[model samples]
Target chain A: MQPVAPSLRRKPTVMSLLARFAWLPLCFVLVGCHIDMYDQPKYRPNRPSDFFEDGRSMRPPVENTVAMGSFEADSALFTGRLNGELAVDLPMELTADLLERGQTRYEAFCAPCHGLAGDGNGVIAYRGPLQVPTLHNDRLRTVAIGYYFDVITNGINRMYSYAHRIPPEDRWAVAAYVRALQLSQNVDADTLTAEERALLGGP
Target chain B: MSAQIFSRNANAILLVSIAAIVLLIVGIISALIGLYLSPWYTGVGDAIEQPVPFSHKHHVDQLMIDCRYCHSTVERVAHAGIPSTDTCMSCHSQIWTNSPLLQPVRDSYQTGEPVLWNRVYDLPDFVYFNHSVHVAKGIGCASCHGRIDQQHLTAKAQPLYMGWCLGCHRAPEEHIRPRDEVFNMAYEPQMMPIADRLALVQEYQIPVDGRLTHCYTCHR
Candidate 1:
């Protein structure tokens, strides 16, 4: 049999080698094309109106001050309506029912911040630098029920709103309890009758 | 003689090629059958039996009690919470005072612990289902939860897939009604017609086509 020609054999070998090398760039091009298409940043539309007016993305606008419409002067429902004006009517005497409801509401909501004795020494108030005012202080005592309701609903400077956690009626109940605390601490000595004065060991 | 050797080589190659083709065909068929028909290829389809044989049918159907009576937080919170022991005791304490069924309630109260009720209608951990939104909509509890009122023991009545949720959310206005009638199964719209409902759904731009099928929608 005739021996195979070296040139012919080399031609087939070289062609196979060239064909193998040609796939390198092709493979890279395929991978690069896919990466370019899929890995690119997607286009998103810019719509300023989608953002909240308060600049907060998630939260609704904070109503820092009470609006006039929210207050219900004679509505009997002490629970202040949401986004309504704050109303106030001071009864001369706090009833037992009012005090009881107030106390229950206080323990649930305020006691966590304003300590059991109405001192500013609540666990959270004491632990944090934010000075939650004591109920014994004249600043808190002189504030109207409406003012207290506003603070509870809207939250004071450092405090967060308890509106979502406590119902509207409960805020009024808490305000009533704060009044009771003030009265208990700062009672008028002259208002007592002779029998009451004698019981108090007063002249 | 050379031709014979070449023929033998060709025959051998042909035999090998035929064997390889047969193997490939068999492999392809096996894969196709496994993909479409073989049940073993399916993952975790077994229904787990719960601890207590609590019947949704008895409570929801026989007693005619609403789903919210037990899962009360469905109207207010993200979860349609399992009823607290006190909630069970509210009825069980008086109604089934002597039954062995009340033992679980008594046990929970005595231990001062909640019954770790086995979850029946569990979605994938990724889905963020807000029971309040659904309850607030006119979607009846039965719409997705299936005929839970008819079951003796409440197994998962619905598959609760993404397609299942999108089927309603895509056209929520069609399902919408007065807020008060949100949970009412027998709610009938008096003021709004079907066209109005459809329009409201469009106006709200309710998500259709299941495009909001993002990982974050359900999962954190």
Candidate 2:
């Protein structure tokens, strides 16, 4: 095609070009305003779901299905029982580190109700207007180590199950620490070394 | 004949119109940028109301409870697990059994429904953040959560802008603390000497080879 004269052909003036595309900024504004990417339809942790019956995005495990590597139902470590009776000792070796770990876990999970010294004087017990049993009592002091694990796992009258919070190994650790706490409060002065007796004062 | 058709003031009026248009564009852009950065848009410090008005200050600062007491899976998982209704009733069943403030919690426990807490510090869906990696790498909870233990009502402490993330990824040594001190809200990052901080970065095996800043590091 032959080219037309410059003036004869239509030319886009700046104003006309701008008028043609005036909605460009509006598009940018609208696109920027949408938060679809920030809040996608996909579920993240704890997001509520309308599709599920319980409205929870997460689902509970199937009934009676044991998880992998957790099938040891008969072991004293898992059941806190030896044959028909509660085991009187830990299934694993006790170390200072284990005691320290037990102390930390105890302070976090148990001390709130049982008292740090197992004297039933925790802040929750005091404010709870409830009488928590003292671990120093003769019955609890003489109870088998597995009894503590069972109590922690199954919970007693007013106490709820802590199985979800403290795992089996930690339960054993706490049992050992509870035994230590009993010994601490029930120790005889004659059993103490000269240095330890002095530390207790009243020479 | 056409030369004198327009008035003499038209030139000045045209110039004024151009300047006004330029100023308008600049003003609009600036206003939008300002809005984007504002607390209203970023949701920084705005405490979203929850079904129950749970106070971190009371539970953490007053009670001295460990962070792991509730957020038990923070050390092992990508998401810090929220406490179940049973976790609440663990203590509430003993104390505060009659308080109206805990009614939702009690109701949830009885009804087997989950308490719906308003989401705080929700990063964009595109971002993949792992709580375990951060904790394992010695990033303190306060480093990102900003003294959440002190906030009576949970709120967004950081704007969670990509650049803000990059600021830490670029120089992690400045923010890294001892692994034991990760949950200590009062821990000061500067308390540890620079050499020790650098040593910790090395000890934790945090990649200083620009991998932390890669696009896939967060976006994926």
Candidate 1 Cα misplacement greater than 4 A, ranges: A1-203, B1-48, B169-196, B200-215
Query: Which of the CAPRI classes, incorrect, acceptable, medium or high, describes model 1?
Result: incorrect
Q: What's the lDDT for residue A120 in model 2?
A: 88
Which residue pairs clash in candidate 1? A69-A85, A70-A84, A70-A85, A71-A85, B57-B149, B126-B218, B126-B219, B127-B218, B128-B218
What is the TM-score of model 1 when looking only at chain B?
0.66
Local error of candidate 1 at residue B152 (angstroms): 1.3
Cα lDDT tens digits for candidate 2, B1-220:
3356568898999999999999999999999999999999999999999988889998888887788888877887899889999988888987888999999999998888888887887788999999999999999999989988899989989998899899999999999999889989999889999999999999999999999999999996
Provide the TM-score, chain A, model 2: 0.82
| lDDT (Cα, tens digit) per residue for candidate 1, span B1-220 | 3433355488889999999999999999998966754334322233446545678766656555556546645767887766666666544543456768668777877775445565555554445688776665555675666555666765555556576676565556556665444544445444579887766555545565565565566656
Candidate 2 wrong stretches, greater than 4 Å: A1-34, A186-203, B1-33
Which candidate leads the pack in TM-score?
A: 2
Task: Give residue A127's lDDT in candidate 1 (0 to 100).
Answer: 41
Query: Mind giving the per-residue lDDT tens digits that candidate 1 earns over A124-158?
Result: 45544446677897777776577777777777665
